[model samples]
Target: MTSGKKTEKYKLILDAAVKVFAAHGFHKAQVSKIAKEAGVADGTIYLYFKNKEDILICLFKEKLGELVEKFHLSIEQTTNAKDALRRVCEIHYGELEAQVDLAFVTQIELRQSSLELRKEIGKAVKPYIVLIEQLLLQGMEEKLFRQDLDVKLVRQLLFGGLDEVVTSWLIAGRKYSLSAQIEGTINFYLNGIKA
Candidate 1:
């Protein structure tokens, strides 16, 4: 196959993996199920992934990489650190809300994987955490946030806060709008970190 077709197939598999993993959870999701969802033969999955765990890891790396890129571009459009922070919240909530299956895999299914898989997944998370620190630093430099705040700690808090909201939404059967929480979540974090 041509490189383009190969890339397309890879993406198809990842997309299908998200649905399968979300529906069945990681432990119960099988490579064959993902292959069936992708409409590819069982052996084809092995061409792109070593196993189900690899599919989950690659799925996260691809998905979160897109998220980090989105955050970067959106932050660039904002004039102030506060707006940039708000953009982060909006994009984070909006994207996940738009793709609840991905959210299900990310927030719920990923946790059931082995520690090594979790660590691999954390590699993708680090860039988003770095982005949070950058925003915090920008806020401090602009005198918008506390000067004495530890960026490291604050980044964890901010990311954790955003993550917890999503996890809660997922746990609650998504009865509420995930996007609706954006304003309040931003307010809560901004209040905690503001100058």
Candidate 2:
């Protein structure tokens, strides 16, 4: 097959893998299921990924990498630190809402992998966290956030709270709009935690 066909096939396999992994979790998901979902032979997945774990890593790298890049680009257009934070929250939650399957795979199934896999995922996630930390620091510097707050702790609280909110919504079968709560959530964090 041509290179273009190969790339498309790889994406197809990854898309199917995300759905299967989200439905079955990493430990229980099998290559056969992913292949069937992708409408390819079982061996086709091996051609694209070394194994299931490799698929997980690639999925995260692709998805999270895009997310980090988008956040960086989006923040560049905003002048105020508070506005940047708001945009970041909106973008993160919006992306998750837009791709609920991937979100499910990311927020739930990915955590079921091995400790080594978790570490690898953490490496992929570092850039995003660094962006949040930088934003929090800027906010603190500008006196929009609490000056005495630990930048790292505040970053953790911000990302962690958003993550939990998304996870809860996903677990609840997405009954409510995750994006709609952004204003209130951001306000609560900014007011309650900021000096």
Q: Using Cα atoms with residue i matched to residue i, what is each candidate's TM-score against the true structure?
A: 0.98, 0.91
After superposition, candidate 1 runs with Cα above 4 Å error: none
- Score each candidate by Cα lDDT: 0.93, 0.88
lDDT of 2 at 191: 89
| lDDT tens digits, residue span 1-195, model 2 | 999999999889988988998788888899999999999999888888998899999889888898988888898999978888888899989999999988998899766778999998888888889988988888878878887888888888888888898999998999999999899888988885565
Position 170, candidate 1: lDDT: 91
Tell me each candidate's RMSD, in Å, in order: 0.7, 1.8
Report model 1's TM-score to 2 decimal places.
Answer: 0.98
List model 1 lDDT by residue over 43-67, tens digit each. Answer: 9999999988889989999999999
Model 1 worst lDDT window (10 residues): 106-115
